[model samples]
Target: MKIERIYLLFYGISFISAHVNAFDPITTTLAVGIGATLGSIFKYFQEHCSSKWISFNSTGLEVDLENKLFGQHIASRIISKAVNGFMNNDNPKKPLVLSLHGWTGTGKNFVSKMIAENIYKEGMHSSFVHVFTSELHFPHASQIEIYKSQLQQWIKGNVTNCAQSMFIFDEMDKMHPGLIDSIKPYLDYYDKLDGVSYRKAIFIFLSNAGGESIIQTALDFWKAGRDREEIGLSDVETALSLSVFNNKKSGLWHTSLIDKNLVDFFVPFLPLEYKHVVQCALAEMEARDLEPDMSIADQVARDLIYFPKSERVFSVTGCKTIISKLDYYV
Candidate 1:
């Protein structure tokens, strides 16, 4: 009887010990899972609630950026690369130039649509990786941190590499000063990056940023001064700068503005496109037409387009370079 009792007690103890051992593992796994879940929640809150996060530069135009700043030759160069040769179906295996322009409502919205709706369906990026973030917003100081982080995972190189993915920043005047300050280094390596990586893209900074800041930049920081402005051009010599960002010569780039600052390349729209843009004004009756000069929109356009620089404070010394290039390169 004593022996039997001892055996029974031993059996009970062994069963309980086995169950406890199994429960140990379950408890450990449960703790780990709970900790992991809390950690993830904390991280998400931190990022989302952060005051400002650095975001990547916008992808492409949501609509057309207009013909005022973006002229035919620039458009042709870009469109050609986009279609690979003006064929209705020409598609490149890699992306093309990054286009930027001044202001909104210039029809810049359609840029990406043309690529995504038209180019992608026809199979443009051949090795066929997915397009991450078909859309993007222009980077602000607020989103720089977040954007830089995202960019690290999505892209491997610097701004010059932005062209590899067809990066463009329209209305660059609004870009944060910090962001512009960061881009100069990247511009220096442009050709090397593009040559080494066929997929490397161009970064076009379209700004309404010019004048005293430009001349000052030319004189001080970049030392691009008179040399950078060149002498042979015609268009910008006498034209009043209509907007802070529009380029008078109207090309995709300020290759002439190279070695200069964003301070240098800005210009205004012409009379040809401003109040004159309203061809229907001719149809108005004499009374209505009498005050056509006084129309609010026209006056605003006039102010924005013809702000005085009588001090000759701002003159476009660079358009000559464009005409010269058009002369030789084309």
Candidate 2:
């Protein structure tokens, strides 16, 4: 049933039921109807337009990035500050658009989860937080047109329901070209589109599209005997965006999302080192309510494969397999 109809039925029933006597047979039937309508109304508001779900805790997000997330000073800082500024703004120019780029296991999805957890009480499972994976959601290249239409409609409908909604597009590197452009209108700086304002919304794109560039930059910093923390956004942001834009394999290749600068921040997640992997294992153990064992954490981190055989400076998988590795050790 439509939300408007549900609302009318709910209020109308409440009025009539108030006047009905407990002894009347009609009261029981009316009571049943009221229960059904109330359920529908509650669900509609919860899934649709409830601001009660969105409560931005900037301090919590900062703490999460500091503790849960490892070896990503650049990503942790950018995400914390970006989210804080956007959430505090009552009138934003446009929806906050963040494009996170890094190799597998570098905490792109993990950071996304932290953001959701700090924003909505339900975190990733929140109805307002929508995640779409390219390989799963848009598998067929032949159905690009259908995917575009469905994508646009889904975004528009959800935004109309709640302006504070969040849409996360995962596996963006695999998304078909031009398919992402369909929602470009929503990301642009417009007060309203079709009378629906999206300024309060947030869009995050996760991809391995610029992994090579990011890895190379990190590798260079290591080779130079420079601290990874010293390697800032300025070092990789331009190259990352360019490489992603020019690379035909990327979803953002030659896309206006880059050309028009619709992407507010291209957050780079640096590859994790051996120490970071150990930290991940230790953190995972604590998450499972187990005492953190340094010896086991070291064993798990050492077992993982690392690159640059001579130096072995970086974990090839960057704590991606830390969980399963922990299972075997513990």
Candidate 3:
């Protein structure tokens, strides 16, 4: 299972060479052919199976955050550092637990995809990656108990199959109050739970729970003429966590996940400014295989709403509606 310990083909070829002198002409040929087939099978498995499929490109991720992701410098830095450190560690004490807090269209889901793409070869479609949206997966409050059992089984089954499996939970704010706590054991420091080790797995929670506090902190910086990039985790993390923990409607409300300090990072995604929205439009145009037209991008950005009535410092929906807005133009 270890990467460096594989010697499938070498051992097979050595065995075939050593035994060839002892066999009849026909038998020798058959033995060699069988050895080669077995060797190929093992080599194929080694190359395509779990753990080996992961190729963490930390440099590539940094470049992506710098070039593709716009406006949320704090999020970009925290995500890069946290994921890089976690991925590089061969024996992590616990799973990497990240709770992304921000308003809609602020790149919570986008960043999740970025992380998945960097870690897994197939990106979001990898068999080991699992995504759960509260609205779709856990819609009924009456089925909380059913959800708890099913969720635990699903996590156990997947992690048992691949230790490095990723579980992304979207719409955490809308999730049932006590629903998430069921999987707290998997996220803990324990090396294994019932023979399955979750230390190498990852858990990402995407929510709008602490968005208000995050926005307030960002707006405070803007009003005081401080650079948006200057706002660090120190400025918003404490408030953000507290806001999410206290909000009764927030999924983690009074939950032990935060109380026990199980959440590794509460990354704050700041609201996008007008310029950032324009950047999103330009990026979208490029994504669509069209030239990056500033005039059209500017028009798309202008059509969207901004906040702080007088100053219009930030986009109300960020780049959430940019694609549709651009569709109207082109």
lDDT string, candidate 1, 157-208, tens digits: 4332233333445554544433333434343323343344423333334443
Q: What's model 1's lDDT at 83? A: 37
Give lDDT tens digits, candidate 3, residues 41-149: 6677652435568788899899889988999899999999999999999999999999999999999999999999999888898888899999999999999999999
Q: Which RMSD values do the candidates have, in order?
A: 19.1, 5.6, 6.8
Model 3 steric clash pairs = none
lDDT of each: 0.34, 0.91, 0.91
Clashes of 1: 35
Error in Å for residue 30 of model 2: 5.8
Identify the runs in model 2 with alpha carbons over 4 angstroms from their true place: 1-30, 33-48
Pitting candidate 1 against candidate 2, the one with the higher lDDT is 2
